[model samples]
Target: MADGNGSEKEAVVVSNKQVVIKNYVSGFPKESDMEIITGSIKLKVESGSKAILVKNLYLSCDPYMRLLMRPQGWEEYSLLKSSQGLFKIEHTDVPLSYYTGILGMPGMTAYAGFYEVCSPKKGEYVFVSAASGAVGQLVGQFAKLFGCYVVGSAGSKEKVDLLKNKFGFDEAFNYKEEPDMNEALKRYFPQGIDIYFENVGGKMLDAVILNMRIHGRIAVCGMISQYNLDQPEGVHNLMSIVYKRVRMEGFAVFDYYPQYGKFLDLVLPNIREGKITYVEDIAEGLENGPAALIGLFSGRNVGKQVVVVARD
Candidate 1:
């Protein structure tokens, strides 16, 4: 291609692979529900345009993404408006993938929901559901760092061990083996829980509500258990909240992006000094993105699930 001066113009084009939804999902999502397709794009930004073309090195496979597979919800990344709501990676000392989990949205979620929403106090008894996950793991660690006694719940024994041994939770349990959640909470928090980081809602929420102390705070981060269901499960313990004077609040990480600088100020130092530990389950290629995403629903991934599209 030649420009106005007849000099050769260089335009680099590349194949863009995307994992797109095949159709709206009804129940538990499967790998077949999403398809990876290849398209091409010019690696150049238009003159006087605010758009910036970025190479996505890592992609986060969060549980909330399942909701977007439905017809009403929209996909997150788009070729256009790429610069909007994007944060620049300022720190290079740590692994870049950390931005997808501990240093990114999930990290902000744990920060806002735990410190801001929960109003955590030193020596408080804290309980975290889905504790081995990207956000829950950090929430447990943050609670421990805040001088609170932390207990976390996961689906499998491996994750249960990871919670106590890796993330430094005071105690951890496998929720799958516990037939009665109320009894589980009673056994873990005999004195009653001061703060509850709600992740997997449903019976867990109901159980936590029954075990909350007076003036207890519940930070509702997500309800992964009810995402793919045709009808969401009902929480039968609403009356207990009134009697216990529990303060339950639901929060969105989107509302807290403006505080990203403050979050990095606290987290980056801890990460650099080894005060914080993080684990990631990496899917090596974009083609594996579907499996990585589906793994979140079934507890297949050991830690934060991430897809690495490129290395450089």
Candidate 2:
């Protein structure tokens, strides 16, 4: 640890760039609400400390992050107290960015929500909202692989096409073009949906509830439509759950992290054998983080939105 002069070398310092909130957000978020600043930090973690310092390669932009922009929400940085909650990347043959989408939290959310929460049966009629997104796309693919008739609803014609053509959903529709969601559901699923992967809530949930078959299962994964609103729109068909004997349940991915290994075992093989496919919208550099993160609420980015800070 000494130079030619026998003096100890100083710890290497680097300029660390970060995206920080300029102020707590209200309503829809904008790029101006966040600021990118550079700060210096030593490369080494302190001795006797349990902290781990990591260089971020990819950062995920998800719908849930909109809530973290509020004053009461929680946020975490690259430095960690320990590796307790971290999952090491075991398979690197696939794109490392997969860790941000298909091999990461979104993948887990789709797996746990569909297989565990929905308890799907083969040949069942399944529907997914926000169908082309990170989680919804996987849910659709999983249903197809499991012998279910999967239908997905996306916001745009392009996304709807991606859902049907790229991801192999049985059917996909642009929800924006559908005037009556109830009728739309009836068209895609004449027999009524046996399983619904609830991503877009409010009106869509109301329609899905009305169209659900007896003893249907609804896995409430997320409600992207309600995130930016001051007052979330209410679903009027709560009583339908009673009459139809539907099992409606909400889940968080954090609760299923314990089964991460099990999830990888199931998905990795499918990924390798071409039984599954994934899509991502990648925004490069830390400077563009704000815009990339803000893009989620507006459905501006297709597929899984990822921010690449560095490659190495």
Candidate 3:
């Protein structure tokens, strides 16, 4: 150790590992779509560039990242959609990975899409597809917090358990086990759904439209089911949207960055008080990033998937 601000430091170069897209993909993404490679970077930043170097402790594995892997113009669309409000970790006490999940883009998507877009009220029926996912889990919990009857659909029993037992959802079912989506929605929302936080698309959207109450709101954050499909399925029940006079709106999380401070103030205390809970599926090491990312399309991850690059 040396006196503060006295010693001259030497720069060190290290092997920086990265997971890069091996090639543009056409259909469902596989681990082969990406490959881990190493490059060298200086441990110290340049003297006057005003650039901040992040250690990259956690890399988020979000479903939207998959859209970028697709061939054609989607790569450009992905960049435009995902380029704003990037986070740089500052606090070290809380898990750094939270920035990639509950405190990050997914958190804002759940907050803005539900409260800002859906305009939820007390005792309303709220249904969230892909409920065990990062954004969906948060949306279900927020609906419960807002005094709504909350139900979620997942792909596996474990995810269903997480929705009901951990996230405080009123009910949850495995969508894969339920062949008739309209019946599944009917079973969960006997009174008809007033708010649907739309994550998965395709037949789920069609079913939800038919089951929506008058003036029901749908906040479209993503359409994960369509991201990998060569030909996206058509929602035949869109006519129901007009018939029921429902409000259907699509939103991106980028539009809500100004509310981030307000969101943190509301959520951080709930987390500390155990009123809110979050789950993450962390894949240790950067090399596992490909598998962790590919897992999203196949429903192999139970919660928010994150890849740990470095530990401090």
Candidate 4:
């Protein structure tokens, strides 16, 4: 390490271009749809405004950002409609990347989507999709910590290995090579699923639906495998939800922003003491950002897909 001369760098805020969604996407967003065009940024925060001016050191590449790609979201809710200040920045002691995973949208999603939505009980049976990915990995670990029997499904064998060995998941399998998804799910979730953390929708969801236990709960975090498709796949096991008395729900992390502090308070200590661990698949430079963002659909990213913008 080298010592500095104790000089502060001048803040500049002439123009900033961000990756913004051009329009509502039907399915599978292309790189061309998002462009880095010129936008304004204030160098200093205004007084009386709790807003913060962040340099965006690192950006999280999350699946839900795809939903935000659509113009109409919770930000446009009739009762919650906002004419101004939709996207704002704030400061935190943790790395900016945390906002993408742990402290960010995905973390809160895993927290609220699991505990609040799934309403997991101790030692219950749990299954997660995209288990080694950002949200699934954390969800599996969370289930284990809650004394639940957890199994996860990933797209690759390496991710499966990491889920079972590295993340301490009870069991994990690669969905890609699995001949029959339903049979695979039945083999792993032999006792039926008490809680299903839905990640990749379509056929995988159909299988989980067929194997759900009575009074099961399903938390719809995302459908990565279905994001890129022009037409979303329909689940054939819809009757199971009614027969099994399953409760399925969809949620967004933005609605739970108020609970973020409460969330960090719960997860931070675990992180510091090594009780919880997070994995990231970081891509350097902004040029490769497009590919990294698209990789989520393909299940190419081993963990959380993060893009490094700048480091200060």
Tens digit per residue, CA lDDT, model 3, 188-286? 788899999999999899999999999999999999999999999998988898888999999999899899999988888888788988899999887
lDDT (tens digit, per residue) of candidate 1 on 1-312: 123222214666667777888888889999998887776666666666788777778889999998778532112223566567776787988999999999999999999999999999999999999999999999999999999999999999999999989999999999999999999999999999999999999989999999999999999999999998899999999999999999999999989988989999999999988999998999998889889999999989988999998877
TM-score per candidate: 0.94, 0.94, 0.90, 0.82
Give candidate 1's error at residue 248 in angstroms. 0.6
Q: Give the TM-score of candidate 1.
A: 0.94
Could you arrange the candidates by TM-score from highest to lowest? Answer: 2, 1, 3, 4
Per-residue C-alpha lDDT of model 4 across residues 39-116, encoded as one tens digit per residue = 554464444555555555677788866766764221100122222534443545556676678767788889998888
Off by over 4 Å in 1: 1-9, 70-78
Question: Per-residue lDDT for 103 in model 3?
Answer: 88
Position 293, candidate 1: lDDT:
90
Candidate 4 regions exceeding 4 Å error are: 1-27, 35-53, 70-94
Q: For each candidate in the order shown, give its overall lDDT on alpha carbons.
A: 0.89, 0.88, 0.84, 0.79
